[model samples]
Target: MGSFHAMHIETRVTGFIEENCYLVSNPDTQEVVVIDPGDDAADLAARLRGQNFKVVAYLLTHGHVDHISALADLCADFPAPIHIHPADAAWCFTEQNAILGLYPAPRKPDCPLVDATEGMVFELAGASWTVLETPGHTPGCICWKLDAANALFAGDTLFRDSAGRTDLPGGNPRALTQSLRKLAALPDDLRVFSGHGELTTIGREKRENFFMQF
Candidate 1:
């Protein structure tokens, strides 16, 4: 088993929305996985240029354009499968479910796009990630939990003091509420690295997040 001490996480604020893209790595082996590569492909590429980290995969928390804007470009540079919920596949690859006309016709990914489902486990950066289907922000929104590191990559579903907006296409208030509750039920010490804001913890969100009140 890989030790959590060897796992390191780096965050990059990218795109117009300043979305947080995470690079989780195992310093010992220099293996990494990128989450939510929203735009600024050049910057992201530059960060990995001399790092000598072997990118194993790209994980998407959801299909929103802002979280996946750099998909095509990144895949071109580092060939790796993309793990995302099937419900958001179209939104990620094509522009079928895009909202607000914010994205152009996205190019299909050069690498394979795989479905991310609940209970599915995969290894990356010397850590095992378990998928949790926490839909609501979008029909296919999901979260990745690295139990070894006690870290959860919660895309846009749950934020620091607030939750994701349910007014977008396929958004559901009730579903989102349930999702928040599910996340809030996690271990308090679990660190949450969201898509667009500061890092938080399950316990902190439980006590401070208004949406978690449900």
Candidate 2:
């Protein structure tokens, strides 16, 4: 875990796919933002309870089940607001989102879901984050940008050495290309916290990641 911009950020790899669930908190106040609580709900919730931090919200990059499967269960314990792009929010919790012989549908949560729109600014604890719409892997794929931390929560939209796949339901190759163009334009110093895999910086990906090069 690293403390950047006066906040402590911890990543927990969960579930069979080893999805990354991030807990970002202010070191002093302990107010936290739970990003992409994918799976292993019980353990995640328990850890949160153990810390006793105030959960301000749950942020979803898109509504893919692997990235949001534990959202409902975690909300049951934390009861914080959820934020996801409207396009993805439409069917994320439905049976249509389930994977055959693998993951099941995520339960709709008691917490309300706030729309995560393009250019939206989230002022949390003491820092600000801007929402960058990067729809491709899913219709509502997004990346959360925290200028203070110089960090981007890339989710499935981006990864190390590659980017998100555009072969699933609602996938669009052209749209993803456009999204990559947008991300490629950003400064290279921002460190990327992807939905899966290890950490990487925008500079590194821009140089090594073929998708970012395009």
Candidate 3:
């Protein structure tokens, strides 16, 4: 498929875990979408201070604390509605989950949280995106596929050479394996921007990622 326009992508590694927060924008139009604003709200805000981009929405790949630590802060600063899968939204606001024990306090998004369903389509940064239900890292883990840009925001599902750990709550090895298979079947040239670590291509992952073999 041909791209409608060129999209510029900037990755910000945030939080103690070094999670990646992606700023996707259409340079020509200055429309932007913020993905997984992990932490370091001050830094995030500073980065966008002089930017001419208009934030359309905030997209969450999953509800993991590390990936959402700065959700409330970012929303407070940008005032954009957040989109996340319903399954993970249930545990996202509470500190009852095992992973929440690691954090000092529970986080509640300051902005409205919208449920994102598989196959849902939305436009951002002048490109159309299709939501893919790729679970296993969490019950509601999702990947946003921007076919026009040939990019996928894969949140802790299928990483560079490894997959998200299944020992955490809601994690299922079998489900992860199935999810990997689903991702592996996508176009080889699709660029993968994962929750953590460097960006990778589907082709490289299919050939080198051990999880893809499953």
Instruction: List CA RMSD, all candidates.
Output: 1.3, 2.0, 1.9
Q: What lDDT, from 0 to 1, does candidate 1 have? A: 0.87
Say which prediction, candidate 1 or candidate 2, comes out ahead on TM-score.
Answer: 2
User: Which candidate's TM-score is highest?
Assistant: 2
Residue 179 of candidate 1: its Cα lDDT?
Answer: 88
Strongest candidate by lDDT: 2
Instruction: Give the alpha carbon lDDT tens digit for every residue of 1-214 in model 2.
Output: 2247588789999888899999988877888999999999999988898898889989999998888889888888889889899999999999989987768998999999899999999887577878999999999999998776778999998898889999999999999999988888888888899999989988898899888766
* Candidate 2: C-alpha RMSD after superposition: 2.0
Taking all chains together, each candidate's TM-score versus the true structure is 0.96, 0.96, 0.94
In angstroms, what RMSD does candidate 1 have relative to the true structure?
1.3
lDDT of 3: 0.85
Per-residue CA lDDT of candidate 1, range 32-120, in tens?
89999988988998888779878899999998888888889988998898999998885656656454656665677789888889999
Model 3, residue 108: distance off in Å is 1.3
In terms of lDDT, model 2 sits at: 0.89
> Candidate 2, 42: how far from true, in Å?
0.9
Q: Write the per-residue lDDT of candidate 3 for residues 78-167, one digit (tens) a residue.
A: 888789999999887776543533554447867888889999998766788889998898889999998877899998997899889989
- Superposed by TM-score, candidate 1 places the C-alpha of residue 154 at a distance from the truth, in angstroms, of 0.4
Residue 168 error, candidate 2, Å? 0.1
